[model samples]
Target chain A: MSPHLLTLAEAAALIAARKLSPVELLEDCLARIAAVQPRLDAFIRMNVAEAEEAAREAEAEITRHGPRSPLHGIPVGLKDIIDLKGHPTTCHSKQRLDHMAEADAAVVARLRAAGAVFPGKLATHEFAIGGPAFDLPFPPARNPWNRAHHPGGSSSGSGAAVAARMVPAALGTDTGGSVRHPASHCGIVGLKPTYELVPRAGVFPLAFSLDHVGPLTRTVRDAALMLNVMADGGQDYTRGLTDGLRGLRIGYVRHFHEKDQPASAEMAAALDEAARLLAAEGAIVMDVTLPSLDEFSAVNRTILAAESSVVHEEWLKTRPQDYAAVTRRRLLPGLFLPAVDYMHAARRRTQLLARVNEVFADVDLLLTASSMDEAALIDDEPEVERTYPRQARTPFNVTGQPAITLMSGLSSKGLPLSLQLAAPAHAEALLLRAAHGYERAAPWKDYAPPC
Target chain B: MTDEEIAALVKAAGLEDTAARYPADVRAALAQLARHKGQLPRSSDPTLEPTPAYVAPRP
Candidate 1:
């Protein structure tokens, strides 16, 4: 039955029906991770014993108490940047390797309370921004779709692990498309819940302003399920929304891809097909214009660089050499940012935010190519700064909104091209519903990489 | 901002202890970026509202 590869939603249903046991599920996932870790290097550490023990308890809980939630017995991976009590939240940096958290980050606590079993922490770009470089103590995670291709970063390992089916879902932080970029490259569903809808406490910050924690899953429903639990109590819940896209307003930022970045042939075709399917399902597809793309990326960079510098200032000063060249060079500018250019960027963000909000007045959601382009070969090296120039993710980051990426089509080389959905702040439920409807109509749920 | 200037900033920032040992070319590039920093407009109003803050507070 390929128990190891079941999506979170499928596995949860089977467990609920007593057709599968958490123990059996956990073992299958552990075995898969064992088989893949050497080639993929997705995990920083594994607590097989702890995971097994938890599974046993979960098995008993199902017998004695029934399921606690969709993830009640589900095994979930966490990016190394999030704090899990008693484990080293290393953020993939040696300087912080020994730093242990005394309590789970708020999201971790919520996941645990909801009955998720933790197998271990996964790898990440050093401190979430310095990666696809080799000088770190741990190797960067390889993409599951093709080991030789990049998995994208800062949430590199989480994307690799989830796409590999080594774990059904994982928690990843998105600051400037960290989650969606990797999901697009690895061919999975990555959801960045509306900014601050999931609390950031105890999670290491890259850019306090841009950093957001969300789920990467094999299915939109799984992401929706995970979002329900991960969302803060004060935040809105979109789980009850199953309206199926009728009469929904969907804005296609086709210009973002068609006229601006020029998506690959496969990507363009996929966008057209996705739009057609959604229109057939009753979504009003309209063309919407965004603010200047260059200005958006530049402002996003300025804010992220400046803020991330503040977060890493201590390490940058104490063990600056410990950082990879990319991180060091990228972060160096923040130190000299004069604090006012940073302010100017912040003020500009206001104007841009208003424009985005105004666009939403005519539409419920915005769509664009998840990435400016498709996946690149693992061995390919571009100039460090040019690696992600003009990412489709900066606008969401700049606006502090929720965004998601779904596999829309396959590239010429057979890699996946993704469609991105961005919803107004705290409107993840609507975004997920729209994504769920598209996913159903064009269901590219889980096409495993021929690893 | 030459390699010398970057070195000076590192030393001034107290990261002289940790900044990577830059080769002539990399140092030159960083120095160029640092100099470009000088070309950025300096805001007379430095106390503007903080960011990720002005984005309508994420609703």
Candidate 2:
């Protein structure tokens, strides 16, 4: 495999063993970017000189002082919404075309301290909401599996870049499934950790209550490795990664996709197969129920719209034309929402959180379909609009729990299908354990996007 | 909400141009938000407190 195609764990181990050089790894990534970028449109900008310089410095420092951490010298991309000191965090929006970061966002500071190299800022939906939009300053990222398809958003580029092997891992923020949505569609591992586990101090806010910072990587273990750096105080998220699913209880929320939203036959079958695989692996898998998907969607959308409106209120009033039509339309409703409705949604959210928390008493983790269908064509507006809201990923976001999306199988058209696993708040270790176990037992992780 | 109501809301929010430019989108968004409100239960446990706007890190 090319150096750029190596998982973060594989590359980190080689770099630590002195068998690989950070500079070489970075150069390989740069070369991959050059080859795939025109087709994938994954990055908003490239920080080549700085990344190369940083890689050289890391190589020398490691030669003298050994590696600082697993992320040492790993080349990672930042979603353009994240600040990187002097770089423009354009957020793939023309509204903020010239906006530059005065300081690194909290997560960026942590990644820098971990010795990760920044290849560039990856594309995001306009302010992480209005895209796969063509009218944005930057072209929307296309799926690496098939350039004609949408890679999912608002973490579009983060997923595409990682899946294409242009970067082993990237930072993505999830508000109502942005991270997991892209990860599912692009066939990668995306984790939206327990809310607030990673600080959101520096990234542009979508919904203050729903926003989460996470990693999109090629492997479950790599996602865990990235979390270790991204998590506050640098937790060793990879510690219990190898714990198999024997005796582990998994709650399969089949109705969320099967009946509530009624996913495509392909997605439903893939989910069932994933459940059977886990059951075969000695996991005590059983059907579990949560509130209807519509209930969760309502609560999530209400909170998201209200909070996002607050964040963009000033701009919406002064420069409404600056936002993409989708973003502007989505945000405009929040402005007109009665204060009572926002309060009611807040109260309902608390009730919903308690309801989900009750399910943890029965199972170690919950499994469901990440996206209802495979990647739709980038310009297929009707399909995009139809499928965009048909997801199980937002329920976990509403509950403020940790959740992960990983490949489960492929659709008939050769597109990736994904399964999601969510654990109670701060139970990322358990969540990852279940996902990692399934990833090993199943053949999904072995397939790579044909970029 | 009716189109007139949505138009009024847009005008009040200083987004008349936006409403004119993307009338269908603006109406759809408003209708969705209204639907979300309709989905809320008529009543809830008065004891249930709302989630805090900001949660401090646990020590």
Candidate 3:
């Protein structure tokens, strides 16, 4: 069996048992990328020589000490926004295509220390916002499930790569649902750790206050393993709460599904079945109300627009023509927000966080459909903005809490359905535990798209 | 904001470049913001103090 086709945990076990060679695994991955990348376009940049050299070093390490960690010989794809020492952190934008980094981002440094092999930089939406575009330096990634559907963005390539089994795991960033949305659509597990839980020092900033770094993998256990390495000192995710969901309080934001925007029948059925299964496993499930989602959307948009505008102001001013039309058009509004409005948005976020805290006082986690609708066909809509909601993920970003999306079931059309689990501030351990428990019961973790 | 008023805001915001191309979407978003104008209380209000949630402790 190809090591590239194994789940991250499976590959780690094989490496630990000396059944897999890091060099062999790297060759398999490079070969698979050679065969599949032309069609999927998931990778943006790759250096065969460097990856081969790293593989040789990793093989030597495994020979001497068995393995460094679970990721000792694992090959993982990094989103382009993350800085790798001596590599360009292009951010999938022409404006920053020439920007090179002198050092790895903190998380990248940690992953390298853990002995993770990097094949190359993965594709991302333009600057992690305006994308799934063709006008950029690289082509947008195609959905592995059906090359015709949107793979979701801006971690578009990361989701597609993992789903296609090009790599067992990949790093992704989420700001307003980028990672989880793609994971949900692509039939993979995506975890967005609590804000600042993973240091963002070397990442290209979209919205400083809202951007979160996370992992996308094939299973909850794999995600857990990845998180163990990515987590900073402040986050302790090894408390072993993930073994069981027994006696955990899982809150369902039914209104998010029942009222805001109705989900497909298959999705609704999956939610009910998932809730029942969790309940069958001794977890408490009940309905919960959130503060007005509309207001939440408003505040999140204001903050994202205002902050991203600030980040790109100089570039926008100097070379507005270089940006994708969507970003230039979407980002232009941020420059208009008054200082008072930005402050008010921040203050409203504080209020919303308090309300969420009150809700968490009753439950350990909150659940919602990652996306109310299934993946839309690529040509179904010319303008993608109309198909999605503005606040599906804004609440968690607003609260600075950790959240994850688990592959719950498939739509009638075979597209994936994801159940989103959000935990309290800095409670990623509990979040992972709950997600892991649900995953074990549902067994959707092993699902892969038929690309 | 009215079309004329919004255009002025766009010009002042240095978005006159793409203003006509996406006027409705931009105006709609601004109009959405306009609705929040009188709803939120003043930032100086005692109820609006920063919570420990947004505070990142000095590392």
Candidate 4:
């Protein structure tokens, strides 16, 4: 396999063994970006000169003193919403097109300290909400699996780049399923760790309370490795990778997608098969119920709209035209929401979180669908509008628990189908271990995008 | 809310351009927000607090 196609784990091992030079890996990535980026539109800007310089330095440093961390000398991309010192954190919006950061976001600083090389800033939705929009400053990222389809957003470029092998891994922010939505559609692994596990200091905020920063990568192990760096020395997220699911209790939330918001036939079947595989692996999988998907969605939207409106109130009031129509429409409701309503949502959020926590009393982890259907056509606004909110990922955001999305199967049309697993807050180690166990027993992680 | 009421709110928020461009979306989103607000519990335990569980780490 080409260096560009190597998983982060593979590359890291090779680099540690002195078999792969960081410079060689970077060149391969740049070549892939040059060859496929026009079709994928995955990056907002390429930091070639700096990346090349950093790669050479990494190669020299590794040769001199060995690896600094598992991520040492590995090239990774940053979603445009994340701040890299002296780079524009555009949030994929014209409104902040000229905005540059004087310092790295907390996650970027950690990744840099871990010796990861940065190739560029990846594309995102306009402020991570109003896209796959043509009206934005940059064209939306197209799915690597099928270029005509939407690579889910607003972490559009992060998903596309990792899935297409333009980069092995990238950082993506999730407020309401932004990371996992792309992971589901693009057939990659995306994890939204427990809220506040990864600091959001320099990343542009979507919803202050719900925002999470996470990794989009090809393998669950890679997600765990990236989390180790992003979480800045929390318990090693990869600690229990080989721990089988035998005797593990998994709560299967079948009705959330099957009834509250029914998934496509293919998605429903894929989730069922995934559940069966876990049970066959000796996991005690059983049906568990929480609040309805509608209730969670309503609460998520209320909180998101209210918080994001505060972030963009100045821009919305002064330069509303600079935003895409979708973003404008999505954000305007917050301005109209009464303060008491925002407070009510906050209060209800507390109760809803307690309800979800009640489920963990019986199970170690929760399983559900990520996106309810396949990726829609890039231009199909009606389908995008209908399908975008039909996800199980946002409920965890409301509960502030750790959640992960990984490929579970492929649609009949060849698009990816995904399953989500969530755990109690601060239980990311257990959550990732169970996901790793599933990835080992199931065959979904082995398939890659046609790109 | 009626069209005029929604329109007046839109104008008041300085989103006349957004109102003109996506009048229905604006209206629907507002209505949805109102519906969600209505679902909030009217009475709650006095001990319940709205603060999130996260505590910021020391710098």
- Candidate 1's error at A91, in angstroms? 1.3
TM-scores for all candidates: the values are 0.93, 0.97, 0.93, 0.96
Model 1, global lDDT: 0.81
User: On a 0 to 100 scale, what is the lDDT of residue A3 in model 1?
Assistant: 74
- Best-to-worst lDDT order: 4, 2, 3, 1
lDDT (0 to 1) per candidate: 0.81, 0.89, 0.82, 0.89
Worst 10-residue lDDT window for candidate 2 chain A reads: A231-240
Docking class of predicted structure 3: acceptable
Candidate 4 to native Cα RMSD, angstroms: 2.2
Give fnat of each prediction, in order.
0.33, 0.47, 0.19, 0.43
**C-alpha positional error of residue A64 in candidate 1 after TM-score superposition, expressed in Å:** 0.6
Give a tens-digit lDDT track for model 4, residues A1-451: 8999899999999999999999999999999999999999999899999999999999999999998998988999999999999888888888988898999999999999999999999999889889879898888999999999999998999999999999999999999999999999999999998888899999999999999999999999999999999995466878888898999999999999889999999999999999999999999999999988887787788889889988988887778789888888788788888776677677777888888879988999999999998999999999988898889888888888889999999888899999999988888888898999999998888898887
**Which residue pairs clash in candidate 3?**
none
For candidate 1, list the clashing residue pairs, or say none.
A321-B18
Proportion of the native interface contacts kept in model 2: 0.47
Which residues of candidate 3, in runs, are more than 4 Å off? A234-242, B1-7, B15-47, B52-59
Candidate that would win on DockQ: 2
User: Which run of 10 residues does model 1 chain A get worst, by summed lDDT?
Assistant: A232-241
Minimal lDDT window, size 10, model 3 chain A: A382-391
CA displacement after TM-score superposition, residue A284 of candidate 4 (Å): 0.8
